[model samples]
Target: MVDRQYTAWRLYTVLRVRSQDWGGSIVVHQGMDNDGMALAVAANLCGAVFLGLEPDPAQARVVMRAGFCDFLVNTLDEALRAMKNEVRKHRPLTVILEGDAAAHRAEMKERGVYPQLQVIREGEEPIPTGRVEELSAMLATADAAHSLLAMVVTANSNAELRGADRAIAEIIPEGDPRRAWATGAPKFFVREQPPRRYVWLDDPELEAMLAVLPAGLTIEPLSHSAY
Candidate 1:
């Protein structure tokens, strides 16, 4: 029993603490990009339930298949209403609304979605898979700053020196962050083992996501022993 408690405590300590430190779970919903997807995966791995409020039906299907998040009200007004009710029920939550600086501010202010919600701007739409090699090189330069690295594998057949999936998978077993999407699978994985900080690596939408990442969130590279 002591060992079990120790392991649980240790895990809670090691996973990312930025969002949960505020004393609640986080909800991440970005535009038509995968940055939100990455956050959804990482947040869950860190033991925080991340709800994705994607508006596009096509994208919503992908979100469901990726096995990372929950469905929520899509529009800003509806989202705010839902969140308020959730909070009123004594549920502590930090909602991350996605959009750029201008759009994010305007949406929240114009529609009154502030306070309980944290705005994370949707990053630039990702580059077509053709740029995967270039993207890989760019990410490698910044790899030293992260702990665990994961990549988003787009279903593309572009002819490149190294395909996006191949490039990212070379470093991490799966270009995926959510492991065991199968029934009764582990919802998350530890950051160490192959450096999970790379979760945001090699995506076009990364810039926008970075642009609005809260100022205080510190990403320390986990362990590299798995490599």
Candidate 2:
């Protein structure tokens, strides 16, 4: 048990606390682009496993290179099956859902598969299209302070990037004393767009979910958190 704990901690430090922390195991929606890649990298640095689901072979190639376990499937059903199998096999400590995961969560509950699984939806409509430039400018301002700010900006740029509605500008305040430069705040941002939503699984909650699995079944932490 001690060895396992130490290993887990080691993995966390390597993937999450190191300078290149990407965070933890993540289950991403396959259509995510370069911006999404940046976010996944960040998450992976933080100690997370990145599971990418996409029907497009080309897109899967991109995700696979980024430490993602690719699932080549067409319909939502196929995607769900692949995800379930991965979850069962890995018993991951966390599951960060992107894209059509909410639907899968619903289906899982209805079928009494992981009936206790809860899906929290975090999304909002795209800020009026006209606001894109305004948001872009804010990102530029934030970027001057922290390079990760640029990644946030890119992640929330559009549906093509990650299907996110919000942008980096919305989260970090300009000229704030707590800016990354001054206080080194964690890079946090989310998209509130419908259909394409982001879900963050807390560590404890994920652990509990995994504990329910039978013995001999264990999940590994894919990424770690820097702070």
Candidate 3:
């Protein structure tokens, strides 16, 4: 069953890559979170392979436990060396990178290692300041069913909200049944009622988001657990 799922995912990845310039070996630089692992699995399921470059042994173990083929490398340099070998072997079309993984990609680009390496940002793309008002206006028109609205707040305001976030938000608030906001990262929906908010922090979903958005952006998951 898992193998069949993997095959389907690989086909999906190929299609996605063909549609855009993004596809191939996805390297999850961040530790394996539920969302992160799901992304890795999705890529593999679709035939796209993944390499999780985690520094901490404990964290790396966690990722491995999640069914990811992970490596214990601390620095981007070390990770790059390993990743390059994988790239040569797999010859993947896209690479999914997070945190320091992106740094490695930048360095490789400078050294001319993988010139085609496209770096996807983490969170949603920035809604144009011109469009913030438009978004606000749209939100205002939302009814009880449209109460749930997905808002992407980044440390950097200039960044764009990810395509996934935008897409999720668009379909969530049509007729105003129950509000649900979707974004690349899980976020606490400010709505006060049953079915609170669905914040997807799973790696698979994030990877799906990454596959769609090839630029690094910070994605913060909204949770009641105050971290």
Q: Report the lDDT of model 1 for residue 224.
A: 37
Stronger candidate by lDDT (1 vs 2): 1
lDDT tens readout by residue for model 3, 2-73: 222222222233323333322344433233443344445444433343544333466656655443444545
Give the per-residue lDDT digits (tens) of candidate 1, residues 154-199.
2212222123223333433342332212111123322122212223
Clashes of each: 18, 37, 47
TM-score of 1: 0.37
Model 1 stretches astray by more than 4 angstroms: 1-22, 25-29, 44-55, 85-105, 115-185, 188-227
Error of 2 at 42 (Å): 1.4
Reference-based lDDT, each prediction: 0.36, 0.32, 0.36
Query: Which candidate number would show the highest TM-score if scored against the true structure?
Result: 1
Candidate 2 lDDT = 0.32
Q: Estimate each model's TM-score.
A: 0.37, 0.29, 0.34
**TM-score-best of 1 and 2:** 1
lDDT of 2 by residue, 1-227 (tens): 12211222223222232234222223332234543444343333343344333334566565555443334444445545555644445433222234454454445446644312111113422211211112123223322333221111123233433322222223335643222221211222223221121212235534443444333333343233221
2 versus 3: better TM-score goes to: 3
